[model samples]
Target: MNTKLLFSIAMILSISIITLMCFLSPAHAKSSTSPNIVLIISDDAGYADFGFQGSKIIETPNIDAIAKSGVTFTRGYVSAPVCAPSRAGLLTGRYQQRFSFERNLTTKEDLNRGIAQSEKTMGDHFKALGYRTAAIGKWHLGNKDVYHPNNRGFDHFYGLLDGSRDYFKQVIKKPADKYKVLQRNGELLTETTGYVTDLLTNETIDFIERNKTQPFFAYVSYTAVHTPMHAQAHRLTAVPESVVDPKRRKLIAMTASLDDNIGRIIAKLDQLGLSENTLVVFLNDNGGALTNASINAPLRGYKGSTFEGAIRVPMVVKWPGHIKENSHYDQTVISLDLLPTLLAAANAKPIENTPTIDGKNLLPYLSGANASSPHESIFFKYHSGRAHIKGDWKWMTTKLKQADGSKKLFKFLFNLKNDPAEQNNLLNSHPEKVTELRLEWQDWFFDMPGIWTQL
Candidate 1:
């Protein structure tokens, strides 16, 4: 062979090797391709309860750090005003009403029913993408054989199946059966010693430790600041006794403790060198319960209502290098959006025959690729009450019974941009707006298969 020809071939081989290295390196390929997802959901938390949301008393440095490190959504909302239906929407990324899950699960009969088996959950999608998935904390979806977390695509499950559990220890099983109890992968845990929040956080850390080398999805659904407002005595030292209301003080302490646990989870991710690639999402399942002394100031109504205070929640998403730090997204976003957004971040695709996802991939908007809002309109329905938001306009109807017993419907129209609290009723002034939104809602409601029969 000629010397020039031999040299040419050698150079070509060297170039090919360099190209292959570029494609295989961890910096540009392999582990860097898919990000880990940590979805943290709080139960019955108020809209303005956390430090990032402008709370004066509650100190949530860890939760606030997520907000400062990424994007904080001001108009974030849950699909439903209450827990079960809201969670149904979150887990499935679709309006819960579409699947006939519109109310809080109240009985064993309801417990038997949960997110339909046919529906694909975020966990199922992540698991299909070759990622480990675990659900630790509250699993209010269901306790039935088909609805268990193991069947719902989680490899590990540690938490309560019911709504509210005692914060400390004692378990009551006699009278009404409303008390919450611990369950680990369908087996009843006779006694879980430590605080539930701290225990769940430790379990989450363990899950991360076991799966740190691979991509994993951790759904940390905390049952904190909910009912059974029992905060650890040590956590309440900062809260003053001058605050005469004991429930409020306990709730404050619970909020503080939740904040601390959040910090612990983040610290664990950082310690494992996983913080940069981990997508941490923080949000509440729904608006707070007034009976629990939750503070939802600057918004109207409480947990079960269709108002902004009930549906709108505090939400923060932190993806170290991908999303801009310390930013705010004011346009409407919902809990349903989490599934699609996380799937996009993880480079995963939805399963075939998956139901139509109501959530939009929020990456474009958060990354400034899209200037317009992710969603043009959002709707809500519970019992006989209904609400619809299109652009800045909102139309809602409230059911009020007369002195005798019959029901009366009171409708109101408001421009949320101007009157976020719904203090001024514009129904009389803007009849056309009311008609347009009402018709829009009616069209969507007809397609829902219509679930509010109990009302």
Candidate 2:
């Protein structure tokens, strides 16, 4: 070979070797694993009640920061419109209905049934994968030992065991908040005369600090903006004089406190240099208060109903570098997606080899791996009735018929993608599609007898 040709070939070979070395580096390797998870679940938050969601009301900068840092779900939904069922789905990877969980939760009385250990939780999956798991705030899953957060794979927990409690006083006169002062595992924290948000935030920061060295799964559920709204005087006093109602201002104050708590946690992560290594997710358990009117506007209906406003919620997930920032996705994702999504990111496996969960891993769909939704057909059987989400079409109706086979015909079919307002009803126009969707729902109901609480 000529000397010039040999020299050129050698140079090309050197470039190829350097390129291969760069590809082999750990920094550029394909990753199936992700960062530590910080799932912050807010209680009874509204859909359009945040700054990022075109709301002129609540100023939620910390909430908006999660959206700006990663993807925001335009049509994010919860498993149920109420508290308990939504927690059931959020904690586990399947719809709450699938476990026969209905109603807003009651205490474990003589005959009351609690969340069974038969079904594993997201914490269990992470714990199995060697990640430190801790649950803080609002553990209404159950009151019994079998259903407690400690028994359900949480290494440490600090929060309520009941459904509702006062924020400042942390107790309602009607039902005593024994669950409020109750603490199990980890140090028992007394009511420090501080705000609930601040207390919860401090516990969350402590959990992160304790587990920062190793991968941790922190489930920081906040019982804020629920009812009997109470916040510090300074936070509420900051509101402008013009836009204020005594009761409404109280709600705003509570919301601001929640936002501030989130800000503290984010700041702690940054300060500890664990921000980039954390996959933070923020979402509301269910829709906001109905009669109290937490303001779920532009969407009809309210909490406890199977309407858009009842279950639709604001959702944001942030993971630096992996998930693109400032991205908004319109996919119909539900709260059940959280369990599997977290497990997939953590590379965790299920315990005792339980049956396949109802939720699909939404990581691919969220990270732009595929164009379609993780769920093509989602089911909702609230109480005892049924609802279906197939493609853009939403079909729902009563389970039983009246004496004349025309019972309370609560049927509504809407193409949510085009008419997100749910203004136009096409049940009469699309009887065929309704029939098809109904059959699919029937099959699902029979297959999963747990959809009904009695079953």
* TM-scores of the models, in the order given: 0.90, 0.86
For residues 106-175, write the lDDT of model 1, one tens digit per residue: 9646756788766889889888777889999888887677888899999889888777787777486673
Number of clashes recorded per candidate? 0, 1
What is the Å distance of residue 158 in model 1 from its true position? 0.4
User: Clashing residue pairs in candidate 1, if any?
Assistant: none
Candidate 1 runs further than 4 Å off: 1-30, 170-172, 175-179, 400-408, 452-455
Best by TM-score: 1
lDDT of 2 by residue, 388-436 (tens): 8888988875444478877474788888888877889899999999998
lDDT of candidates 1 onward, in order: 0.86, 0.77
